[model samples]
Target: MLSALRLGQIDRYLLGQLLAGLVASTGGLVALIWLTQSLRFIDLVVNRGLSLAVFLQLTGLLIPSFVAVILPITTYVVVQFTYQRLASDRELTVMRAAGLSAYALSRPAMMLALISVVTCFVLDVWVVPSASAAFREEQFRIRNRMAAFMLQDGVFTQVSDDMTVYVRRRDSDGTLHGVMIDDARQKNAHATILARRGRFLPSTDAPRVLLLDGTRQEIDHQTGRLNILTFAQNVIELSSNKSTAQRFRDATEMSLGELLHPDPAVVTARDRPKFVVEAHRRLTAPLTAASFAMVALVAVLRGAFQRHGGLLRPFIAVLVVVGLLAVGLMIANLAARVPALIPLIWVHAIAPGMVCAWMLFVPELRLGRLSSLIPGAAA
Candidate 1:
């Protein structure tokens, strides 16, 4: 009973260390990735005049997706590091001498991997889909509707692909001074408008600007004659006639059911393979956490201890993991194109852990030395 209690205490200590290392490494990597990824949207804040809070809110929706992708990798890294440290400190040696088997020593890491698997499932199935939808919707709104309102004082702002607006000065009362617009929405009738003063109209569907004392100038396409018309007040729509209905949902923004049974109207036959691949990817991705943790355990705990601490096994394990990650990426890409190979994804996610677990545990069982495989059995 005393030995069992002591073993439990050691397991708790190991689990605590693994959990701490996982949190720190995961957080640091996530923050670094977020910084790099958020750079793609820095123009929204700098050029579009979006506030810092709004920028943070928009980019923050991406954290769940990032966590889901990196959790398995981080789990493997933490387990590998923690076990190697214990071994280098001769703590694993002490545990082995105390009659702790390989399974007993690896129990804490298995628990950690299980936790990661559960978290990854929750993120991939629920949190990521909703957050991705919201991010895309918000990005669309900012580009289409709110972009006109974000015009800077002196910089030319591309409100939409077909429209460019420039304002010389903007007042706190929402009045603009000296505005110019280059409208190319019409195929052959490109027009340039110059306004002495203007203000954006309150709108939700499409942005519009009301110009005062403005002149609309256009060159006739056929005759090449410049025609200028002066008006006291005119309303120019800032964005093209694009409605929210025109926005198509991406696979990342779809739930599992939606991916599996997509609307034929929205998803064409050519795109069906992509949807199927995404659904299967989400289902199988979480299983990789267990597989990766098992690989790390096989690296640190599988072989006999060297008096001088060998680096060959750990280095080989790292190479194997990198190779597996590359292969997984290739398989996902191939499956996306040729979905007949979808079973490869499931095999990729599950096979490594199964093989590693057998190598680590089943061989010991086959030796007919159950006493050596169980903690305190030799006693």
Candidate 2:
């Protein structure tokens, strides 16, 4: 009972340290990535008149995707750092002198890694799909419905592929001054209109721009003919829905069941392979945490102890982990092209972990005695 209590205490302490490192590394990486990516959306908040709360909601929905990608890497870092610290402090040496096996030393880190694996699975299976769907829906709304309101004073904003709108100044009463509109949606006829002032008329469907004292210049593509019309007032129709009626739903947004047996009506025959590969990828991705943690543990604990730290083993451990992840990604890509390669994903994810576990544990035990238990070995 006393030995068990001591072991429990040690495990708790090591688990705490591992958790701390995992949180810190994952949070910092996620924050760095978010900062860089969110710069692309700054126009939405500053120029598009989107509220800060809405901006945060849009950005926050992406956290699950980031966490899913970073969890395995962070798990490896936590295990490597925690075991290296224990070794550096001679705690591992003391434990070994006390007759604690490498398996015992690895238990805490393994537990932590298992927790990370479970968390990653949850994110990959459910949270990621739901968040991705919500993000696509919200983004579609912003691009199609609220684009006109995003126009900034003194800046030309491309509302869509073939349309650009510019405004010099927007008055307090919502009147726009020095407005310019270019409409090239038609393949043959293109129009550029310059107006002294304009206001957005209230409409239920399409965007209506009421221009005052404007000159409309229409150019014919077939002939080098330009038709110019001077108007006192003109109302131009703008697209309210720039994107197609189809909502964007990628394989990443599908549930595991849906991805495995995708509806033929919803997913085309050519795209079925992509969905199947994604489902397999999600299933295999979480196992990388355990594989990575085992790699870190074996790197530190399996080798002979040195009075001075050696960089070779730790560097090799990092390379091994990187190779595993790279192989897994490459195999996933190939699996997307050829469904027969799907089994390789599991092999890439889990084989390293089994090998590392054997390297860490088998050397410490009497394999000769275990082999002697075989019926044919005695004969």
Candidate 3:
């Protein structure tokens, strides 16, 4: 009973270390990645005068996807590093001397691997998809419906490729003193308008401006004659041609069920394979964490211990993981092209872990069996 309790205490200590290392390493990498990724959206802050809070909120939605992508790799890294440290410190030797088997020593790492696998599943299946959709929707709103907010005093803002709006002065009350618009959205009937005053109207789909006491001037292409019309009030929509139409949903924004059973009208035959591949990718991707953990265990726990620590096995494990990542990418690409090959994604995700687990633990099990078969082995 005392020996069992001691073994449990050791397991807890090992598990605590693995958990702490995994969290610290994962967080640092995620922050670094977030900084680099957020650079792409710096224009919103520099050019559009977006607030820091809003900018962070807009970019923060991407965190879930980032975590999902890096969790498996980080799991492998943390496990490999922790076990290597243990071996170098001769703690693993002490555990082995205490009659702990390979499986017993690996229990904490396997537990951590299981935790990582569950986390990856939750992020990939639900959190990432929801966050991706929200991110795209927020981005769409910024580009289309927020054109009115982009306007500034004494500056000509290009609301769209063919439209420009200039405000002579803007008041604190959201009123424009003098407004001018150059509209060329129509190929044949390009119009320019001058307004005495204007105010932006709230809209969900596009930005709308209501002008008071405005004069519209346009030249007729057919007659080659310029026409001018004066009006008390006029409403003009400031939206790009793309914004006027419906936004198409990408694979990242879709739930697994939606990806698997997509609307035939919305999804083309060419895109069906891509959707299927994405669905399967999300399902199988989390499994790689367990496989990667096994690889790390095999690297540190398998083979004979040298009196002098050697880096060769750890280096080889790193190379093997890199090769596996490359192969996984290649398989995903190939499967996307050939739908029949989708099964390869599951095989790639699962086969490595199974092989590594067998390599690491089967010999120990064989030895136990042979010893049990011999007389007086139980004693």
Candidate 4:
């Protein structure tokens, strides 16, 4: 009973240290990246007059995706840093001298890694896709609807790739004065319009602007002739950035089931491979937390401990982890090209964890023989 209680206490202490490191590393990275990424949408808040609440909601929707990317890396860092700290402080030495085996020493970190893996899995399977869908929906609404209402007086605002609108004045009653529009959506024709007064009209499919006392000057490309028309009132439809009139959710926004069993009618031919790739990526991504955590544990816990610190060991671990990440990315890209490579992605994710676990648990496995396989292992 005493031994079991002591083991429980040790596990709690180790888990707490790892959790602290995980929270700090993950929060700092997420905050830094969020600051840089939020700058991309600053124009929406500053120039487009979006409300603070709306801005916060829009940016907050991206947190799940960010967490998905940061979780695995942070788990690895937490394990590496916590174990290294314990070793450097002679805590690991004291524990080892107390007759704790390698597996006993690593049990808490392994359990923590398993927890991280499950968290990552939840984010990958559900939270990220739902959040991504919401983000895209909100973004489309802001770009297409809110931006139209943000039209400033005497400022040229681009509504779409082929449309630009300039308003000299906006009345309290929502009427526009001295409105000018440029429409070049057509390949063979370009039209420049000027109106004395105009008002925006709401439509479900396309947005329209009503202009009174307007003149439209159109230039025909084939004949190269300028045709001018004066009208008492005219309605102009603005082209949208989307190719199809209906908005289609991207693969990244689809649930795991939808990605795995995509509707052929809804999915285009070009997007089929992307869906397959995304499905495999989701399956493999969460397992990376386990793999990365194992790599950190094996790197630090193996071999003799230096009195000061094992700087070279951690450095080599970083290099190995970086190489693994590079290989994972490269494999993902290759899997997208040739479906045969898809299985390799799973291999890359699982093999490292298995290998590291063996090295950590098996007393027979020596770091010396593995030195030849890994360049800096001997060092």
Instruction: Output the TM-score of candidate 4.
Output: 0.90
Residue lDDT tens for model 1, 1-379: 6777787798899999999999999999999999999998898778667789989999999999999999999999999999999999999998988778888889999999999999999999999999999998888777667656578889898877788899999999989999999998887889999999998898876778899999999999899999999999999888875643478899999999999998899999899989999999999999999999999999999989876677998898899888889999999899889888999999999999999999899977887768756766654
- Give candidate 4's whole-model lDDT: 0.83
Candidate 3 structure, TM-score to reference: 0.91
lDDT (tens digit, per residue) of candidate 3 on 85-156? 999999999887877777778888999999999999999999999999999998898788667678889999
Query: What ranking of all candidate models by TM-score puts the best one first?
Result: 1, 3, 4, 2
Tell me the whole-model lDDT of each prediction, alpha carbons only. 0.90, 0.84, 0.89, 0.83
Better of 2 and 4 by TM-score: 4
Better of 3 and 4 by lDDT: 3
Error of 1 at 142 (Å): 2.0
Off by more than 4 A, model 1: 145-149, 222-230, 240-245, 371-379
* Higher-TM-score candidate of 3 and 4: 3
Identify the runs in model 4 with alpha carbons over 4 angstroms from their true place: 202-207, 220-225, 239-244, 268-271, 364-379
TM-score of 1: 0.92
Candidate 2 regions exceeding 4 Å error are 152-156, 167-169, 177-180, 188-198, 201-244, 367-379
Clashing pairs in 2: none
Residue-pair clashes per prediction, in order, are 0, 0, 0, 0
- Model 2 CA lDDT for position 373: 25
- Candidate 1 whole-model C-alpha lDDT, 0 to 1: 0.90
